[model samples]
Target: MSPFYFGWLRWIMVYNSSIRYIDDSLFIDGIDLASIVRQVSTPTYIYSLKRVGENYRRIREAFAPLAAQIHFSVKANGNLAILRSLSRAGAGFDCVSAGEIDRCLRAGAPAQDIVFAGVGKTRAEIAFAVSAGIGWFNVENLAELHYINSSADDLGVDAVKVALRLNPQVTANTHPYMATGHGAAKFGLTADVIRDILTRQSDYPRLSIAGIHIHIGSQLGDTAATLAALDAALDLLAAHPRIRTINLGGGLPVAYRAHDAQPSLGDLVSELIPRLAGYDVLLEPGRSIVADAGLLVAELLYVKRQAGQVFYIIDASMAELIRPALYDAHHEVAPLRKTDREPVVAQVVGPVCESADVLARDRELPALQAGDHVALMTAGAYGMSMASNYNARPRPAEVVVSESGDNWRVSRRRETFDDLAQSDK
Candidate 1:
């Protein structure tokens, strides 16, 4: 186990599980990190095709008894290579925009298997989803319902199959920005409100009231909170006989460190199956399906040491990855090449200018040097997808590794400045 120590944050590794999917460890089916760094230097987004498949299998096995339709939430990680790999493994999609919908379709997901969802969907986006014959629209409010009905009617189609995303008035013990279950949040409607809408659904002939949907939160860990939300939804589903499907929205937690007590999806499925016996089950897992399977490889540009601090600046910035900047998210940080040092106090930061662009703050880990490699662990989901183009820095490139398979393919190439300014004209 690799022990890391810092003033405030230190990863005490009980077991040092080797980084997979990239060239970090020497294994029967692992890419060599030194080789990759030799080719693509620091700030590269590395994905493990093999681990992605394992994650999909884990979810599939979890909901095996029920006809679990696993929809990979694209908002987390929307790389075409990753999407195509999961699609080939029988994964559907939960999309939030027309561009995502189009990307899913291009990645080989059938329109009938995709679910379109978002709060502020535009008219053109609505038209585009309908035109694609998407299976369902997760309507967030009454106005969207009206817009969808009008759009479907204009397209001369039958009522579009839809699910009302229920905002279960419960507190998911997570960050406020990521939590959607709280009653006061603006994501979904309450039970009483959904009931009101169901009564009014009769007025809109172009809308098919098909299912009940609610996403409690993102990156949740407490079993009790998740089960409570599921039980609450089950109670509502049992009371309302018309609802044909029940979507226990995504947000299962993934392990950032090897010792993190992340529950198996099987445990969750086993506990919730009894309550959800008859209804068709829909699992919209985003993070659990891709988090561990990916890694963010950064090259150590320069290592500075002062009185009591060290700064390991890498090529990647918050503009290339936003979880650190947005949620103050914690991803395990480690030196790629083994180094000799008891431990040193250091901060793992990026090249971005903002003070909030910190990745790992106050940590004690082995010494790093210029041209060394460090990895940001548990970054598959929401890592690449949440990237921005701040500071005029182009996003980093992404690649995937598989066992006895393709080593690395450019999932997304870092854009050139000319490419960025091309659309301005």
Candidate 2:
């Protein structure tokens, strides 16, 4: 084994077994980072297939004795390889767009196992979903309901199964941008609005309310808001006993820092599974399944110091991983190699031309130099799925490390400048 150093000058070998250092180099799933960077190149996304499977099994086992169905949220990672792996494990899909449906289909997920959820689905999108014969539509508003019914009628399809997304007004103490079930959030329908829709259900004969859906927010550490939302939905169900499904949308938080005290999936299952008895339940889990299983490896390009403030610039930018810049999200930054130098306060910035391209600020890491490697931890979720070709920069590639870590396959090849210009009309 290599060596491990934590802030102080002391050194030891074998840190976290999942991600360890051997011969002063980081190894993910037993694959050396120095070799991966040399072959796959830096600024690449590396996912541990074993870790993902472990997470999936953990969630499955937690809800096995309960009436729950695991629907992997496609918006979290959306990589085909990842989707295929989950699909093989009997996990359904929770998609938000026509494109996501297509991706899920391409990933070998059946149409009956895919549920589409979104607030602003266009008429065309609704028609596409109808054509695809998706399982259910998590209708957000009356307009969407009407549009979906009209589209189903136009396509000569039978009754379309749907779940009305209810805004329980339960505040999910997460980022405001991600909170969805609040009274003011532009997502789900209010209770009064839901009642109106039920009263007028006969008007849209082509739509059938098959279930109730509620998603409070992402990165939720506590279960209070989710429980409140569920109770609100259950109250509505008392008046309408025909609704058999409850879609507790994905918002299970992940621990971005080592010290974070995020609850386990078992904790959630223990608290909610019993309450959801006697009903067919659906859970849309995104980040909780893949976040901790992935990492973004970047190559340090330059080290700058000015007025006692130090900055370490890397090849990755917001164009590659936007969670930090978009949500002001926190992701642990760590050196890929062991170091004995005293820890220094520094900001880890990326190559994006914008000032908000910072990944982590006021962080401490071993003094790193050019050509060294660092990883953005817990980046498997919103990291690449939210990436863009900002500043005309091509996106990074992705590699899925096999169970043994002895074999790693490139799930996606690095984009070229030509790829960026292909859609330029």
Q: Rate the local accuracy (lDDT) of all candidates.
A: 0.79, 0.86
- In the range 265-348, model 1's lDDT, one tens digit per residue, is 677777877877888888889998888777788887878776677888888778777887788888877676555466776788
C-alpha TM-score for every candidate:
0.92, 0.94
Clashing pairs in 1: 5-364, 6-363, 6-364, 23-31, 23-32, 23-33, 24-33, 42-299, 76-382, 159-206
RMSD in Å for model 1? 3.2
Question: Which candidate leads the pack in TM-score?
Answer: 2
Clashes of each: 10, 2
RMSD of each: 3.2, 2.8
Which pairs of residues collide in model 2?
Answer: 2-22, 2-23
1-425: candidate 2 lDDT, tens digit per residue: 22323444433344333566677877888798777888989899999877888888877787786757899998999989899999988889999999999999999998989999998898888999998999999999888888988898999988799999999998998998888888888989999999888878898999888889999999986888899899999988889887889999899888887666546777777778677888888889999899988999999999999878899999998898888888999988878886767677899999888999999999878888999899888899988999899998889999998876687889999999999899889
